[model samples]
Target: MGEQHGCQTCHGDTDAHVADPTMKNVLVYQAKGGSAVDELSAKCLACHDSDTHMAMWKMSKHSRNDISCFNCHTMHATRGAVDQPTKCFTCHRDIKVAVNKQSHHPIIENKIKCSDCHNTHGTATQHMIKDDTVNQLCYQCHAEKRGPFVWEHSPVEENCLICHSPHGSRHAKLLVEKVPNVCQDCHDWSRHPGTPYDANAGFTGSSPSNRFFARSCLNCHGAIHGSANFENHGLRQ
Candidate 1:
């Protein structure tokens, strides 16, 4: 915040970054490079710890998890030399895998950023999410799903994560699981006698094969996310 100068101000004794300034005493954040995570972040925080957004740094998830400023921000590079996405993926490989699946947010395409839905700096919400709840964050992009509908799906009314995977999914709609399986999580309790929705019980066997194919649940319950209808049993758009 004040007049700051020289690499030594942040790096603190350039020789320390070097294992020996001559040999192997220097520490590395990676298998071989730079310094320790705590040292680096502490140095940065010594200068920046007073900032408004950084007020919660002491209690932040990243701080507690040993994440340093360099984890997301690079020093001594051109303005945009580093890619935040790749840096983020380094720690969150699980999310990296999820986003690469068939259906996902447009993060890889650069239409979205990890920071778009997450503060990453600090937040009161779990996962450092920017909103009070997952559904609230999702409603920023999917306002249609935030309906005060005439009929509400129980899980949908509760949490979007119950039916959807926010990162990505192999399923067509970022669904947590496949369609009927997603529906079956709730609807499997009740069924008629001698007429099951399994692989062998529909219209002379042809019905089961065709009707219960991929996303058969959606074919009937087209408005699965939610529907505003007062008729048709409230499962329509």
Candidate 2:
């Protein structure tokens, strides 16, 4: 069948010819056992060696774990467009469940794909992110949040993951925790180094717990991350 169907006809060429000899190292593969499965996989890797993104796959966790290129992608288009978490979920079911929860990065709704945020090929970072910094990667989509404002929340500028789960979140607004506690994380009343506040009485009276915590604190304190207003009092901006 190799001659009848012409392996070269379907697979293009299998000979070793290089456009750039310097990239010779990219053709590395394991076919030691030399079975049909191993040989076929090695054949697929031949042409893929020319792709720069695939070159980085060698250093990835998935590569180390024996995940091959065909695991998530369909070069031949047999499995349709290969829906995002659907492909990823095939291996990571638990994470898929979490990613399908209440709030997330829109991957579930197909607004974005996992490959948009992650490099299936290897990266300097463990998660295979395309960039060196996590926040920098997130800023590609949330450009509005990327700012050098006079008042900056350290975590917002640092890593969005500190407060949000990039894949999915159970809480509203993609927060790791609910509002008041989420704000209280770094901005505890005691730790407000700018202008101190009274935490002695935790909202008593008939005021609803959720309303008091959510609005009262954030409303008066217009800018949770310290305002630039020169005339501002404590938090009454």
| Top of the candidates by lDDT | 1
lDDT of prediction 1: 0.73
Q: Which whole-number lDDT from 0 to 100 does residue 48 have in model 1?
A: 76
Model 1 misplaced stretches (Cα beyond 4 Å) = 1-4, 13-36, 49-53, 191-215
Q: Mind giving the per-residue lDDT tens digits that candidate 1 earns over 8-106? A: 676556666455556444334342365677777777777776664576676889889877787677666676676667878998999999999999989
Each model's Cα RMSD:
5.0, 8.4
Give the local distance difference test score of model 2. 0.63
Worst 10 residues of 2 by lDDT: 25-34
TM-score list, all predictions? 0.77, 0.68
Tens digits of per-residue lDDT for model 2, 1-237: 233443353343434325554433232333342234334445666555656556666667877776666566654467657667788888878768777889877777778877787777677785888788888898787776776556676777678888887777799867888766787787664564332233554645324543434435555565543346644522654
* TM-score of candidate 2 relative to the true fold: 0.68
Q: Which run of 10 residues does model 1 get worst, by summed lDDT?
A: 189-198
